[model samples]
Target chain A: MRTLLASLLILIVIPATIALGIVVLDDRNYYFISLLIILYTMIPFAMVFESRKPQARELIIIAVLTAIAVAGRSAFFMLPQFKPVLAIVIIAGVSMGAEAGFLVGAMAGFVSNFFFGQGPWTPWQMFSFGIIGFLAGILFKKGWLKRSKALLCVFGGLSAILIYGGLMNLSSVTLFASTFNKEALLAAYASGIWFDLVHAAATVIFLFLLSRPMLEKLDRIKTKYGLIER
Target chain B: MGRDSFSTYHPAVNFLYFAAVLGFSMFFMHPVLQGIALFSAAVYSVTLSGGKAVKFNVIYMLPALFILAAVNPLFNHAGMTILFYLKNGNPVTLESIVYGIAAAAMLVTVMIWFSCYNKVMTSDKFIHLFGKIVPALSLIFSMVLRFVPRFRHQIQAVSLAQRSIGRDVTQGNVVHRARHGLRILSIMATWAMENAIETADSMKARGYGLPGRTSFAIYRFDRRDRTVLVLMIVLIAIVLAGAGMGENTMRYFPSMRMKEQTLFSGVVYAAYSLLCMLPVIIQLVEELRWKYIVSRT
Candidate 1:
C-alpha cells in the first residue's frame, strides 16, 4: 500500500514538475529540464527500492548483473552498437523483478559511462535503458510477455528501436537545436534510423542466444540463495 | 591527475560550483556570457587535465561545433533577416546560424565542464553525497564500481582458459568468435553468481544493513570550505539576480535583441566570469603561493 501510494505520488508529481519547468524556464533550457525530469523519474524508483530494506544478498546479485552488463560491452568492441547490455538487462528483468531490473539497467548505464565518458547523454541513456528493463519486467509479470526465445527477441528488438533509439535521437535533437521544431525532429530521426536499426538487430540477436542460459542461471541463483521471491 | 585547489574542497562545494556554472552556461545565451563560459571552461579543463584536454578540445569538440553550426541553418529558418534560400525553399537566416553557433558552443562548454566534473568528483565523493538519500542504490553503485574491474580481469582469465581449450574467440569466423565470446560470458556469469554467495555471506557476517552504520570519509567542512562556499553563493546570487532582471539572456529567434549594457549588467557579467573561473583562479593563487613559499624556503 505504501509503495502504491508512492507510485501514485510520483505519477502525479513528475509530470507536474516537467510542465512547470517547461512553462517557467526559457526554451534554451529544454535540455537541462528534460535531463532533470529523467533524474526525477529515477528517484522514486530508488526511494521505493530503498524503503523496502533489501537484504545484502539481493543488492549483491543486482550489482553483479549490472557489472556484467557493463563489462560485457567491452567484449563486443569489435562490433559497434552490438552490445550484450540490453540482453543482460532483459534477462535480469525476466528472472529477478522489476525493481531489480531497473536498478541493474540504470547502474549499468551510469558505470559504463564512467569508463567511456560522461556526457550530456548520460541521463537519457540511463532513463532509456532503465525504462526498457522496467517494462520488460512488468509485461512479463502481467503474463503479456512470455519466457520463450522468439517472443523475447521480438520484444527486445521493438523496445530497443522504439524506446532506446527514439529517446536517444530526441536527446540529440534537443542538444543540438535551440528551438524544437518538427523539421529538426524528422531530420534527427532520418539520420539516426540506420544506427537504430543496427542496435535493434543487435538486441534481437543477443536475446536470441542469451535469454535461455541467462534465465536458467538467474533461476538457479535465486533457488540457491533464496533471493527476492516474486 | 593535475592537482587543483578547488578539488580539495568538500564534495558539496565542488558539486555546487559545477552545478552553478553548468546551469548558467546552458541557460544564458548572450554572446559575451557564452564566450566567458567557453573560455573559462577550456582554461579550467586544461588546468585540470593538462595537454590532453587541449587535444580533446581541438580534435573532437572543434569539428563537432562546426558541423552542428552548419547543420542548423539547413533545418531551422526562423529569423527576419533571410540570408539566402536553400534548394528545399528554406530561408537560411542569420538568426539560425548564430543560434546554431551559440547552441554548439553551449554543448561543447558543457561537455568540457563535465570532463572537469568527472575528474574532480570521483566515485567515492558521489557515493558519499548520495549515500544517505539512497543507501541501497549507493551501495549497489559502489559494488558495481568494484565489480566491473574484477569481472573484466576474470573475463580475460576465462578467455585465456578458453583459448587453451581451442574454443577461442580470436581463432574463428565471425559467428564462431561471437559464440565463443558468449560462451565465455556465460561462464563468467555462472562464476559470478556462485562466488557472490560468499560476498553476501561476508557482508552478513560484517553486520551489513544494520542500523546506526557509519561510513568512513576523509572530507570535512572546514573553514576553507566554508569561505569558498560563501563566496560561491554570493556570486551565484548576484548572477541569478541578473537573470531575474533579464540581463543575462538575449533574444535570438525571429530577431536579434539584447539587454542593454548597463552598470548593473557589467556587475552581473563580472560576477558570472568570477563564478565560472573560480577553479582556475583558485589554482592560480595556490600555484603563486607555492612558488613564494618554495623561494623563501
Candidate 2:
C-alpha cells in the first residue's frame, strides 16, 4: 500500500505540479510552485525508504553505497565524463530495490554538492538523478530494459543523461529567462547536446563494464550476511 | 564551519533565515527588492568570507551572469520597446534586456545565500534536525559527509602504498595504468564494505534505533533562541505577505512594468532587508556588547 502511494505521488502528483508550474506565467508562482514540486518529489521518496522498516544494517549498507557512488567520480579522473556514479546507483537499484536506488542517487547529489557548492541547481540535480535511478529499478524489475546487456546499457546511458540534461536545461530556462521562448530553449538544448552525449556515453561504458560484477557482489553480500530483509 | 555565532542559534532559525533570503530572491522579482537582495547578499558574503567571496563572485558568478544576460537578447525578441535589430532581422527589446539582468541577479543572489548557508548550516545541524525524523537517511547523509574526506585520505594512502610496490597509475602504458587504477578502486571498495560492516557492528552494540532511546543534544532552545525564532517568523511573514499583495512583482512579457513605490511596499522592502541582514545584526550586537563589558576594566 505504501509503495502504491509512492508510485502515485511520483507518477501523478509530480507531473501535475510541473505542468501547473509551467502554465503559470507569474514568476512568483513559478518559483514557489517549483520548490513545492521538489518537496513533493522528495517526501514520497523518503516515505518509500522508511516504509520498508529497514534495519540499521541495511541503512549502513545504503550509506556505504552512497559514499562509494559519490567517491566514484574521482576514481575515473582521467576520463572527462566517464564517472561510475550512475553505474553504482543503477547497481544499487537493481540489487536492493528502487527506493535504495533513489536514496543513493539523491544522496550522492546532495552530499557531493556540499563539496561542489549548493545553489538553485542542487535540487534539480537531485531530482534528475533520483528519477533516473527510479526508472532504472523499474526497468530492471520489469525485465524489458534488462533483456540484453546491450539494451540495458543503451537505456541506462540514454535515459539517465538525456533526462538529466534535458531537465537541467529546462531549469536553466527558468533561471535565466522570465518568459520561455521556443527558439531560446531549442538553442539552449542544442548547445548542451555534446556534454549530454558525453555523459550518456560514459554511463553506457560504466554499465557495460561494471554492472555484472557490482550486481553479483551486492547479491552475494545481501544473502550471505542474512542482513535485514528490507 | 567551526564554532560560529550563527550556529549557536536553534537550527530552526538558521533554516528559516536561509529560506527567507532564498525565497525573497526567487519570488520577489521587483528591481528594488532584487537589487537589495543582491547587494545585501554581496555584503553578507564578503563579511562572512572576505576576499574569498569577492574572488568567487568575480571569477565564477560574474561571468555566468554576463553570459546569461548576453544570451537572452540573442534568442528573445519579445517586447514593445525595441532597442535594436539583429542582423537576422530579430528586434532586441529593452524589456528582455532588463529581464535578463534581473534573472542574472536572482541567480547570483540565490547562489550567494546558499554559500553563506553552507557555512552556517553544518552537517551536524542538518542531521540533528532530520535524524530522528528520518533516522536511516540522515545517518546516510552524515556518513556520506564524514566519508568524503576520510576516503580521500584513504585513497591517497592506498596510492602511496601502491606506488611503493610500483603499481601506480603513472608507472605504465595506458592499459597497465587503467589496471592499476582499477586495482586501487577494488581495494577501496573492499575497505568501504568492511568499514561499514564494522561501524554497523558498533552501532548494534550501542543499541541504536532501539525502543525508548533518548538522544543527548548539545543544542538548548533557550529563551534567547525562542525570541529570535519569533522575530524571524514575524519578519518572514511580513515579507511573504508583502509578496502576496504583489508589492514585489514585476512583469516582462509585452513590456516591463515595475510596481510603483507605495507605503506598504517600502515597509516590505525594509522588512525583507532586515530579514536578510538579521545574522549580521546579531553578530554586530554581540561583539559590541562583549567589548563594552570587557572595556569596563
Candidate 3:
C-alpha cells in the first residue's frame, strides 16, 4: 500500500502539480517551480527510509558509500570529466536496496555541493543522481540488470546520457534563460552534448573497471558485518 | 574576517534573515528593489569575506552578469520596442534587454546572498534546524560530513604509501598510472569499510536508534533574537504586501509596464532594503557601540 501510494505520488500528483504551476504562475517562474518539484520528489524516499528505522551498520554503510563518492572526485582531479561518483552509486544500489541507493546518491550530491559551493542547481543535481541510483536498484532487484561488467557499463552510460545529462541541460534552460523556449532548450542541449558524452564515457569506463572489485568488497563487508540483512 | 555581530545572533535569526532576503530577491524584479538588493548583498558579502568577496564579484559575477544579460535578449525576443534585428532576423526588443538585465541581476543577487549564507549557516546549524524533522537523514548528513574529510585524508595517506612503494598514480605510462590509482582507491575502500564497521559498532553500543535520543546544541534564542526575528517578520510582511499590490514587480512581456510609484511603494522599498541590509546594519551599530565603550574606558 505504501509503495502504491508512493508510486501514485510520483506519477499522478507530480505532473499535475507541474501543470498547475505552469497555468497559474508566470512561465518565467519555471526555476522556482521546478526546484520545488525536485525537492518534493525526495520526500517519499526520506519518509520511507526513516520509517524503516535502519540499523546502525546499515546507516553507517550508506554514509560510508556516500562519503566515498563525494571524496572520490579528488582522485581524478587531473582528469576533468572522469569521476567515480556515479559508479560507486551504482554499486551501492546493486549491493544495498533501492532506498539505500537513493540516500547515498542524494547525500553525495548535497555533500559535494557543500564543498563546491551550493547554488540553484543543487536540488537538480541531487534529483538526477538520486533517480539514477533508484532506477539501478529497482532494475537490479527486478532482475533486468545483472552483476556483469558489460551490462552495468551499458546501464551506466545510458543513465549518464539520458538521465543526468538530460535533466541538467533542462535545468540550465530554466536557470539561465528567462523563458523556456524550444530554441533555447535545444541550444543548451547542443552546447552540453560533448560534456555529457564525456561524462557518459567516464561512467562506462569507471563501471567497467571498478564494478567487480567494489561489489566484491561490499559483499564481503555485508557478509562479515551482517550489514543490512534482509 | 572576524565573526560579525549579526552572525553571533541565534541561528534561527540568521536563517530567517537569509531565507527572507533570498526569496524576496528572487521574486522582485522591480529595478529599484533589485538595485537595493544587489547593492546591499554586495556590501554585506564584501564586509563578510573582505578581499575574497571583492575578487569574486569582480572576476566572476560581473562578467557572468553581462554574459547572461547579453544572451537573454537573443533567446527571448518577446518585448515590443525593436532595438535591432539579429543575424537570425529575430527582432531584438528593448523590453527583453531590460528584462535580461533584471533577471541577471536577480540571479547574481541570490548567489551573493547564498555566499553569505554559507559563511553563516554552518553544517551544525543546518543539522540542528532539521534534526527533529528528519532524524535519520540528518544523522546521515552529519555522518557523511564527518566521513568525507577522514576518507579524503585516508586516500591521501594510501596514495602516499603506494608512492613510497613505487606504485603511485604518477609512476608509469597511462595504463599503469590508471591501474595504480585504482589500486589506491581499492585499498582505501577496503580500509574505509573495515574501519566503518567499528564506528557502527560504537554507535550500536552507545544506544543508537533508541527512543528519546536527544542531540545537544549550543544555540539559545535570547531576547535579542526575539526582537530581531519580530523585526524581520514585520519587514517581510510589508514586502509581501507590496508584492500583493504588484509594486515590487514589473510586467516585461508584450510591452514593459511598471506600476506608478506611490508612497506605499516607497515604504515597501525601504522595508525591503532594511530586510536585506539588516545584518550589515547590525554589524555597523555593534562596532560603533564597542568603540564608544572602549573610548570611555
Candidate 4:
C-alpha cells in the first residue's frame, strides 16, 4: 500500500503539482502544461532505470536529442523546407517504444504551442502526434527500422502526416462546425484541406532528410546503452 | 485560530470558489461586469504577487491580442457602424470589432483569474474540498496535473541521449528524417511498456483499488472558514439576483438612446466583478497578516 502511494505520488502527484503551478504561474499556456506532463511521465521511467546509474555521457546525449527533436519540430512551422515533425516522430518511435514515442510527439505539439498559446486545438495535437509515435513503435518492433527497410520509413512518414492531418480536419469539422448544418461542415472540411496538405508535405520532407543518419546513430545507442538485449 | 491564516478556510468554501469562478467565466456577459472583471483581475494579480503581474501579462495577454484580431472578425459580423468592406464583400463593422475586443478581454480576464486562483488555492485545499464527493477523480486530477511537466523533461533527456549516437534526426530530407523520428518513438514505447509493467506490479502488491481507501488531510474547517463561506454565498446570491434582473429588463445589446446608467445596475455589476476577485483579496490579506505576525514574532 505504501509503495503504491509512493508510486502514485511520484508518477502522478508531484508532476500534477508542478503542472498546476506552471498553469497558475505561466499564463495557463497549454504548452507549459503539456511540457509538465511529459516531464512527469518520465520521472517513473527515470526512477526505474536509476539503479543503472545512467552515465553523465548518456544524460548529455539524451538532452541533445530532445533539443534537436523539439527544434526540428518547431522549425517546420517557420520554414517550408523540411519535414521536421516526421523526423522526430519516426526517430522517437524507432528508438523508444510506442509510449515514449507518443509522449515525445505529443509533447512536441504541446510544447510548441507555447509560442502560439493554448486553445481547443492542444488536445487534438497531443492525440494526433501520440498515435504517430505509437504506430512507429509497432512497425519498428517488426524489424522495419533496418537499412534494407527504408521504404518502411517513407511509409511511416506518410502515415503520420495522413493520420494527423486527417484527424485534425475531422476535429475542425466536428468541433467547430457545431452550427449543425451539413453545408457548413463540408465547407469547413474543404477549407481545412489546404492547411492539412501543407502539414502533410512538411512531414514527408522532414522524414526524408533525417532518416538514414538517425537510424545508424540509434543502432549505435542501442548497443552502447544496452537498450537491446545481447 | 486567526482569521487570516490559510488553515482557516473550509473545504466547502474552496469548492464554492472554484464553481463560481468557472461558471462566471463561461456564461456572464454584461459589459460593465466584464470591464470590472478585467480591472479586478489585473488589480488582484498585481497586489497578490507584486511584479509577477507583468510576467503574467506577457504570457497571457500578448497572445489574446492575436486571437482577438484573428478569430472575432472572421465569425461575427454583427454591428451597425460599418468600418470597411472586404474584397469578398463582407462588411467589417465597428460593432463586431468592439464585440471581438470584449470577447478577447473576457477570455484573458477569466484565464488570469483562474491563474490567480491556482496560486491561492493549494493542492491540499483542493484534495480536502473534493475528497468526500469524488475522492478518486480528485486524486486522478491531482496526479495528472503533477506529472505533465515531468513527462516533458524526460522526453527532452531521452531525445538528447538518442541524438548523441550520431542519429542527428534534425538534419535530413523529409522521408529519411521521418524514419529516424520513428526510431525515437519505438524506444519511448518500449520504455513506457516496461514502466507500466513495473507500476502495475507495484500497485497490485500494495492492494490498490481496494474498498474503503481513506485519505488523511492536513486541514480542518473552523470559524474563519464559516464566516468566509457565508460571505461568499451572500455575494454570489447578490450577483445571481443582479444577473437575473438584468436579463429580464436591461438592454445588453447596442442601443441609440443614451439613458443614464442606473445606480442599482452599476452596483450589481460592480458586485459581480468584485465577487470574482474575492479569493485573491482574501489570500492577499492573509499573506500580509502572516508577514506582520512573523515580523513581530
Candidate 5:
C-alpha cells in the first residue's frame, strides 16, 4: 500500500500538478514544464521503486516493460512505417489489467513528451493513449489476444490511432477556434486525418506482422520466469 | 551531482515560484515587459547555470522562432503600412510584421522563462507538494517521468546489442528497416507486458490505493518560503490587475499604436516580468548562499 501510494504520488499526481502549474503559469510553457517534470522527477522514482522492490519481480518486470513501451512509442518518431506504440500498448493491456494498461499508455505519452517536449496537447495525448490501452485490456479479457481473435487486435490498434489522432485534432481546433473558421477546422481535420490514417495503417501492419511472434515470446518469458498466473 | 542543488527547495516556494512566473508572463505584454522577461531570464540562467545555460536555451529558441513565424502571419493580417505585395496581391503590412515580431518575442521569452523554471523547480518539490492529493496519479506520473530516459537508454542498449550481433537496423533499406523496427517493437511489447504484470503484482502485494494513505514529504515551508509566497501573491495581484485593465493589449489590426506606454503601465509591466523571474532569482540566491556557507565551513 505504501509503495503504491508512493508510486501514485510520483507518477500521476506530480505530473498533473506540473501540468496544472504549466497551465496556470503560461500555456506556452506547458510543454517545457511537463517535459522537465517527467525527466527530473518520474524517471528517478521509477528506478528507485524498482530497486527497492526487487523481490516483487513481477513489478520490476512491469517497470522494465513500461520502459520498453515508452521506448517503442518514442521509436515511432524515428522509424518510418513502424507502429511500436500500438504493439506495446496492446501488450500492456493483455498483461496488466485495464487500469494498468491505461496508466502505461497515458504515461508513455506523457513521459515520451520529455524528448518531444510538452505542450497543451500532452494531456490529450495521455488521455487518448490511455483510452487505447484501456480498451486493449478490456478486449484482451474477452480473449482478443488469441490467434483466432488476432484481427480484432489489428482493428483495435487502428481504432486507437484513429481515435487518438482525431481527438488531438479536435483539441487543436478548440484551442484555435477563435482564429479558425469552419474551413480552417475542416482543413486541420483533413490534414490530421491523413496523418492518422498513416499512423493507423502502420499500426495495423505492424500488429499483423509481429503480434503472433511477440505473443509467443511473451508466453515463453512468462513461463520461464514463472510470471504466468496458472 | 549536487544533492543540495537538486533537492533543496520546499514545495510551497517552488509552487509559488511557478505560479508567479506564469501569472507574470500572462499579465505582461508590452515591449518593456517582454524585454524584462527576456533580460531577467537570461540573467537568471547565467546565475543558476552559468555559461552552460545560454547554449542550452539556444536549442529551445529555434522552435519558438519557427512557431512564431508559422503562426503569427497566418492568423494576423491587420496592418496599415504595406511592406510588399504577394503574387496574390495581399498586402504584407508593417503592423502585422510588428505584431508577428512581438508574438515571436513573447514566445521566445516564455520558452526561456520556462527553461529557467525547469532548472529551478526540481522533482522533489513536485512529489512533496502532490503526494497526498492523488497518490495513484502521482506515482504514475513520477514513474513515467522516471522511466522515460531510462527507457531511452535501454533502447540504445538494445540497438547497440543488435548492431553487435550484425543486425543493425540503421544500415538497412526502407523495407528491411521496417521489418527490423517491427522486430524491435515485438521485443519491446513483450518486455512491457512483463513489466506491467510485475508492477501490478507488486502494487497488489504492497496494498496500493489503500484508504487513508499517508505520504512522507522531504520539503518544508520555511520563513524564506513564506516571504517568497507573500511576494509572489503581491506580484500576481499586480500582474492580474494589469491584464485586467488592458495594459497588455497589443493592437495589430487597422493601425499600430502602443496605446501610449504610461508610467503606471511601465511599472505594472516591470513588476509582472520580475514576478516571472522570481523563482529563478530565489533559487540562484539560495544556491549561492549554500555555496558560500559550504565554502566557509
Candidate 6:
C-alpha cells in the first residue's frame, strides 16, 4: 500500500510540479524544469529501492549493466547511430525488474553524458531511457512481453528508439528555441526522423544478436546470487 | 590530466564555476555578451589545451558554429525585417539570421566550457562531491566511469588476441568483419558481467553499504576553496538577478532590441568576465610564481 501510495504521489507530483515549474521558472531558466522532472522521476526509483532494500550484490549487477550500456556507445563509434546502449539497457530491464531497469537506464544516460557534455538535454535523456527500461521490465514481469527473442527485438525496435529520439526532439524545440511554435516543433521532429530511424535500426540489430544470450546470463546471475528477480 | 589549476580546488568549487559560467553563457543571448563569453571560453580552452585548441576550433567548433548559424535562417521565418527570399519564395528574416548567430555562439561557448570541465573535473572528483549525499549512486557512477576506459582497454586486448587467430576485424570482408567485431563484443560482455560479480564480492568483503561504514576523502573545503565559493555565489547571484531584471536580455521577435547598458548591468558584466576568467587567472598566477622562484635561484 505504501509503495502504491508512493508511486501515486510520484505520478501526481510530476505534472503538478511541471505546471508549477512553468509558472515559477523563466524561459531562460527552463532547464530547471527539466531538473525538476528528473527529480520527480527519481522519487519513484529511490522509493522502490528503499522498499526492496536491495543488497550490495544486486546494486553491483545494476551498476555493471549500466556500465555496459554506457560503454556500449563507444563500441558502435564506427557505425553512426548504431548504438547497443539502448539494446543493452532494454535487455537489463527485461531480465531484471522495473526498478533495476530504471536505475540502469537512467545511469546509462547520466554516465555517458558526463563523457559527452551535460546540457538541458541530460535529464530528458535520463527520463526517456529510464522509462523505456521501466516499461520493458514491467511488461516482462506481467507476462505481456514474452522472453522470446523475436518478441523482445520487435518491442525494442518499435519503442525505445522512437520514444527516446522523439522525446529529445520535443525537448530541443522547448529548451533551445524561444517560442514553442507547433510548426517549428513539427519541422524539428521531421528533420530528426532519419536519425531516429537509424537509431531504431541499430536497436533491432543489437537486440537480435545479444538479447537472448544477455538475458539468459542475467537470469543466471539473478538466481545464482539471489539477485534481482523479474 | 593534472595540468589545469581548477583541478587543484575542491570539487564543489570546480563544479560551481562551470555551472555558473555555462548557465550564464546559455541564458544570456546578448550579442556582445555572447562574443565576450565565447572569447573568454576560447581563451581558457587554449590555455588548458595549448596548440591543440586551434585544431579543435577548426575541426569541431567552427563547423558546428557555421552549421548552426546557417540552419536557423532556413526554417524560422519570423521578424519585421526580411533578409532575403529563399528559392522556394519563403522569406528569410534578419531576426532569425541574428538569432542563429547568437545561438551558435551560445552553443560553441557551452562546448568550450564543457571541454574545460573535462579537463578539471575528473571522475573521482565528480564521485567525491556526491559520495556523501548519495553513496550508492556515486559508487555506481564512479564504477561506470571507470568501466568506460577499462572496457576500451579490454577491447584492445581482445582485438589483439583475435587478430593473432586471423579473426581480426580488419582481416575480413564487411560481413566477416562485423561477425568478428560482434564476437569480441560478446566476449567483452561476459567479461564485464564476471568482473562486476568479482567487484561486488570485493565490496561485500569490505562491508560496503553497511551502517556507520565511514569513508576517507582527500577533498576538503579549505580556505582558498571558501573564498572561491563565496565569489562563485556572489557572482552568480548578481548575474542571475540582473538577468531576472531584464538587464542583459535581448529580444529577437518582431524586432531586435539590445538591452541598454545600465550601471547594474555593467557591474554584472564585469563580475561575469572576472568569474569566467578566474580559472585562467589562477593558472597564469601559478605559472608566473613558478618562473619567479626559479629565476631567484
Q: Which docking category, incorrect, acceptable, medium or high, applies to candidate 4?
A: incorrect
Backbone clash tally for model 4?
96
For every prediction, compared with the true complex, DockQ reads 0.78, 0.61, 0.76, 0.05, 0.18, 0.44
Which residue pairs come into collision in candidate 3? Answer: none
Candidate 4 C-alpha lDDT tens digits along B143-165 = 33333344455556777887787
- Count steric clashes of candidate 5: 42
RMSD of each: 2.2, 3.0, 2.2, 12.0, 8.4, 3.7
The CAPRI-style docking tier of model 1 reads: medium
**Arrange candidates by DockQ, highest first: which order?**
1, 3, 2, 6, 5, 4
Residues B74-135, candidate 1: write the lDDT tens digits: 87888899988999888999999998898889998999999999999888889989888888
> Could you give candidate 3's per-residue lDDT for residues B1-297 as a string of tens digits?
467788888988888898888877776778999999999999999999999999999999999999999999888989789989999899999999998999999889988998988888888888988888888899889999999889888888999999999999999999999899889989999999899889989998999988877778898989999999999999999999998887987788889889999999999989998998999999998887887888653
In order, what lDDT does every prediction score?
A: 0.87, 0.78, 0.88, 0.57, 0.61, 0.79
Off by over 4 Å in 5: A1-65, A74-83, A90-102, A119-121, A134-202, A209-230, B1-7, B23-28, B46-52, B59-67, B79-84, B122-124, B144-213, B254-263, B283-297
Q: Point out the worst 10-residue segment of candidate 4 chain A by lDDT.
A: A24-33
Mind giving the per-residue lDDT tens digits that candidate 3 earns over A39-61? 87898898888888878888888
Interface RMSD against the true structure, candidate 3: 1.1
TM-scores of all predicted structures: 0.94, 0.91, 0.94, 0.53, 0.66, 0.86
Task: Say which prediction, candidate 1 or candidate 2, comes out ahead on lDDT.
Answer: 1
Each candidate's interface RMSD (Å, one decimal) is 1.2, 2.0, 1.1, 12.6, 7.1, 3.1
Please, what are the lDDT tens digits per residue for candidate 5 over residues B125-200? Answer: 6666766654444565566666677656665676777777665578579887777766665555555556566666
Q: After superposition, how far is residue B151 of candidate 5 from its true place, in Å?
A: 7.2
Binned by DockQ into CAPRI classes (incorrect, acceptable, medium, high), candidate 3 is medium
Give per-residue lDDT, candidate 3, residue B258.
90
Best candidate (score: DockQ): 1
Model 2 spans > 4 angstroms off: A1-32, A75-82, A147-149, A227-230, B1-4, B156-166, B170-172
lDDT of 5 by residue, A107-198 (tens): 67766666565544666777777677777778778875444336645665566556777667766653332233455467668867766777
Could you give the CAPRI-style class of model 5? incorrect
Candidate 2, pairs of clashing residues: none
